[model samples]
Target: LMEEGYFEPNNESGRNRDVYQFLDGVAAHSKHMQQEGEARRLLRNLIFIFEENDLSQLRNRISELILYFKSQYPGKKDLPYIQQLKGMLREWESDLKWGHLGFNAFHVHHLRLGFYKGEIFTETPRMDRDVAPLLALMQQVKPTIVTVALDPEGSGPDTHYKVLQTVSQALRIYQEEEKPNKLEVWGYRNVWYRFHPSEVTTLIPVSLNSMAVMEAAFETCFGSQREASFPSYELDGPFSRLSRKILVEQYQDIKCCLGREFFNESKHLRLRASHGMVYLKKMTPDEFFQTSRELKKSTENIE
Candidate 1:
């Protein structure tokens, strides 16, 4: 908006005025922005600040932001190897954050079967073509276990549901032809949803240090989603922050029910008294199908 003149600075006049100047220029005072409704509006409007950065532009913008912060505000603290930072923010790594993960990353061509609004279910042929390579990958790997997001009904942004359907379909075909002897489907939830203790088969404890790692990884890896244009209304920041909040909340809830002593005195003290716990539901192929089928029905009805 600043670049496009939809917004203007209060005192600054340069075309490349940074965010602080932009806020001052527009008189977006902290007192004014602190109002709940106004804060939400500002958050939503600013979420997609990098929505159209075609890789190279995204990289450039990251550099620009760093430089803007460094040279312009080279205070007595905070800085880094500016040239070293340029590579990551530009990679096509929306999913896999770390550059090393690229060693195993496979880009499924034309796999983005839907747009922002989610898959409408009318694009069957396109979806089928996209799912073909995935099935082929399964055949080649012959993995015994697979993990998938299990956001029910209205939990996630529509894409997770679309992916669930696609993966489920591929799994069915793979099982039918390959006749895999044993396969376990592990369903997990993140910021979009949660599973009650009774609903989960296992609780994998997350370390306090791991929580810090998660935050750092997110803030570093997802430069584009820093603004997360279509962020959840529940929070003003990125989904990573929301996920961390959810995890902490879950830990507190567990402490209440199981008693804090159970954690603090457990043999695995570090893990037991950790920041969060992962809820996992393990199922056979048939059971996975049942759960997914129910979720599919609910999603379609809602749609």
Candidate 2:
């Protein structure tokens, strides 16, 4: 409005000058007047002063009047200005909380998942040395419950024995520390490392069998390994015992017991089946058991 000339400055000149005229105005000091002409002339002079740049004097007069009012009501007992200010502050705070921060209940769940996945470690592995910060973050985020699903052989140590050893050490550490909330591991068959519900972390390994049998079974039931691979699960590590069972279930059109029910063939299932057979079949006992003491000593001697 200021830019569009909806309002005019008292001192504006030339092209910007757009003035309004008022007639029959009464002067505030008319009580001291003796003639009507004096009153009219005084009002005309006041209008001319407003046109001439007398805004500063008018502002000073307004300020003096405000000071008088404040002095009369020092606590502002009858004014709603305090309430208006409070309402503005509350609106600003609400905008900051909902609009700027963009935080909600779901964030806590995501944070809990990220915490369990060691995504924080991925972000800053050095922070692993001081878990207090992570615990504090967990508390601040405040997840109701955290569920962790781990295929340990796929993501644990680089190889099977090291994974076992690491899990063992972790189990011992958990036992010693006796931490409150725990972990759970899941798979098809029975595992060597089992956890009591009371434990902080649970280790579950479902043993399975070779992929060749699974592929052969997929071929048998679905007429192609692709269909069979969807229902079949191959040995993920040397310890998996359900590999044969997974293959048999796939081939015989029997229901798979390892969580999945529907069999929609996709690239991942095919690749996993093909890759599982290609790699797992090629592995010999010696290659799989790299941590054997005799083999390690032989390897060292070779080095």
Candidate 3:
């Protein structure tokens, strides 16, 4: 995906003819067709709808987005994205129920913010729509721990990095205005990035039982990502498999250091030790800011 040098210009006329036919009765037959297949079809043929030139139209509630699609396409059973979204919803709802959200509230807010619509999280004359939700969340939740991903290779330069920047601004504002209590940031990385031995503050052992549980949960939910259209690193398989591979690789690295004899001798702990470990870097609010600063180059006029 990151090829340098000039590439041949795309011929508009040579565009695939199927694009036209696919989108022809999309509004009508989308209900009759498979949700997953229809979602992929929409993505292939009409992704440009999301890239509307108008910035205002680009920003919307997920509800509004769904409504817009429903209005645009009549007689739709549901978009494939809808089915996957439902799966995610079911997972979260089930988790909330299992965890017992008695006194604590579990709120999931969608900012729907992006740089593609020319949105900037950096200092400007006015506040960015993206950072506002995060700022509000801080005031509303008064969370003891705020979690953010450290990975930086998402859509581009990691949509996550951009998200982190905005979050930094939000935390900055929250600190200045609210004078919040002691807060910690739990920084995480998927397969894209990881904490080095020197940086890790904690380690969670990944056991075979835990791996089975994770695999079950992942398979039951996350259908959209399990079968992503534009896959990660051109991988045809699910990211879960790649993640497991990485975990095992890390375990091997650890096994080399500690000596295979140490693990081979441990009767009860051997299985889990062979599986691998999860590294965690817990940071304070100040350390959180410093980490993001180190992650990015150039200065922002946030002050």
Candidate 4:
């Protein structure tokens, strides 16, 4: 090829010396390896080299090497080293076995590095004991309906949905020991949110005061007591409105709307307006967002 001038020694085609060096190293090591362990080590080194150099050509080289092995070894049982390396290489090519290569490694590395340096992934953060305010508010209001609205403008395509899913998951866990109230979700414009108060006949727009009250409830129960800030927005009297009649007209309607069947009077407890504040008092913001985002992301991604 070089004699035909199709390639050159130091031109663009030759600029990637790392590939040649790696191939040469693999060839030299493969030739001298007599023991299975040594062969396995060389194969691992080649894989590392390919990964480090981003040499996609290594994939083709892998195929060629495997073919060479089959031709040379001819199903010999003594070839333990070749068999191990071959099995691993084959596993890497399989979608089910190697599918995690796309994201899991990055996720794990990010988590590990965050732990080492004490940094947070804007995507995820740790929670501490601080959620007392929201719990208190919940106890006071005894709101059968709780609405969680994510900022439409600030959210990405999947972000809003994930936020709602996170909230729902938390609700599920919170109500595991006791039956939960009927929950409903509303998606409009770009906003995704949930409304609570299992028996609400209509949704009255939540007021600034109501949001403040809700924020306080959330902070006490689910956020840092110092300052649990949710997204801020301009609002007037009745910040939110929903038809309560739609929520509890029938169990079928509820199931079709929310995809959650929490309506059995025996299995699900009704929210008592008087006892709401007491219920809210039990909340702590320790793991509010920390445990939810990943779970939410995973949930939405799968769906």
Candidate 5:
């Protein structure tokens, strides 16, 4: 659940906030949490952020950002941006609900390649090298539920599809070796893309309060996105705003079909929007692997 670039700083609403600014905000929030006497807990979930390369010439800019953070935080002046970012992530992880359950974790992969909008497959070696360790990690965790972005070809950036392929391949390898077990691969989409109502199998309604919390987390943890570099002109506000609209729309659609009385009588329905987070059809591990392989082969043919 991590990306190489911190945020799309070019977004108009983001105001050109860079990675350094984002990490600063995250560090500040971590300090605030510490002062509040919050307990520190381990996180089980893994988050990988590839840092060696990025689009828009971000590698050099990230180097500059590291120096900026080093200068800003006297105590951490000697450390690099990646280290500082890791520390901040650890702190944020501590504040997550998963942290309370001692199941939060993250990693910054030092992969050799950077992410170009449509060149993920062209850099096959990097992708395959990255996937080997991931396969091993998956074997260790043996998770039953693996969630991934449901991005289609030519939608958003190509990185999303590459990630989906990598995870799917890893799962395929792991399943071949281990005992047969039930596995569910959940496909999700966010602001960059969306799942059609007909394509969705799950809808987790979110409350206004929960939305606020999510926004706060974004504000605190994603300083870089505060002033985005590549702001979307099509949208009026941040991605969160888009998310709210989508969730509300989904909730309304459901209510309309089920009748307003159904929502009025349910306590949870009263607080939640008309629609919630939408997921695409769930796929079994074998199904996902086959789909990913087919997509990979198609890409190869085109290349």
Candidate 6:
């Protein structure tokens, strides 16, 4: 599409030229494919093309294609292309399945966390209602390690900060009753914000192959967020790409500060151009709870 002049970089203004050209190209392609009786081929080509891009872009393109196909030939499932497309869509949906709580059930099952049914906080913020269930869940799990985003006010979204506070509150309640064997809290941030070198206590190295796998998982698992309404203004690509860039930059910083031998000597660390590092900050349960409480109070004072 770029070579054919169907798409170009928006040098004039900060707009998504890719998205506009993509939708146009798909519409034209669908029409041509239908006339040529190559709808199945078109579907195959779409799947192949999107695999090269990020999850959000792929999701958006797929959604547009699906709508185009349905409108072009409604109630015609008996057709070969239509049947194949429907089957493909069914498989895709199944693979990217999510629970009512907006979490991948497959991930939860793999982690062996028990599921609890509850209403998702969409419109109104229900602190007590949300915290109560999480507290109960924490007591049941008795997890030694708890990880939450270190998102502050005015971060990517209010939901991230809210979730952190809720988890912290639940942990505080759980600790009051019983202490886990080795309780630890890990604060992590991605895309919107990242921890400075001074703030990071842990630097975990990731292999190039693992990074590729992570991108694939994001594309396949987060089906709903494929077409984000509020994408990052600074980053033109998907969230996964932003995360990758951050990790790589961190690794580069470490190599510049510490000699290459540091990574070479470490048995667990592997160095490569494609390899990346994730930074994390460690905190005590009480410290996390206190931070959460302070955040809550600060927000309240502002209101």
Each prediction's total of clashing residue pairs, residues at least 3 apart in sequence or on different chains, is: 3, 14, 0, 41, 27, 1
Model 4 lDDT, residue 247, Cα: 24
Q: Mind giving the per-residue lDDT tens digits that candidate 3 earns over 1-303?
A: 003211112222212222222233333455333344333333322223343323344345345766756675322345554434444344333332232222111244434453423222322322456778778878998888888887643333345677777777898788889876788888877666666767878666687776676665455335445665445673467767767776777777777777877677777674434587777789988898988887764334333
What is the TM-score of each predicted model, taking all chains together?
Answer: 0.63, 0.18, 0.59, 0.21, 0.60, 0.58
Against the true structure, candidate 1 reaches a TM-score of: 0.63
Write down the worst ten-residue block by lDDT for model 2.
14-23
Tell me the alpha-carbon RMSD of every candidate: 14.4, 30.6, 14.9, 23.9, 11.5, 15.2
lDDT of each: 0.61, 0.30, 0.56, 0.33, 0.54, 0.59
Q: Which regions of candidate 4 are displaced past 4 Å? A: 1-121, 125-140, 150-162, 177-183, 191-303
Candidate order, lDDT descending: 1, 6, 3, 5, 4, 2
TM-score of 3: 0.59
Cα misplacement distance, residue 256 of candidate 2 (Å): 5.7
Specify the highest-TM-score model's number.
1
lDDT top scorer:
1
Give per-residue CA lDDT, model 2, range 122-193, as digits (tens): 222223332334444544544333222212332332233332333333333443454434333322122222
lDDT of 1: 0.61
Model 5: per-residue Cα lDDT over 132-250, one tens digit each: 77776777677888888867555665667767767776777788888556789887887677667776777666667777767666545444455554555546566566666777777
Residue ranges of candidate 5 with Cα displaced over 4 Å:
1-103, 106-122, 125-128, 267-277, 290-303
Alpha-carbon runs more than 4 Å astray in model 3: 1-106, 114-126, 153-157, 261-274, 298-303
Candidate 3: deviation at residue 186, Å?
Answer: 1.3
Model 6 C-alpha lDDT per residue in residues 216-264, reported as the tens digit of each score: 6565435434555467886776677778888888888887788777676
Using lDDT as the yardstick, the better of models 1 and 2 is 1
Least well predicted 10-residue stretch by lDDT in candidate 4: 272-281
Q: Model 3, clash count? A: 0
Better of 1 and 4 by TM-score: 1
Pairs in clash, predicted candidate 1: 9-25, 10-25, 47-227
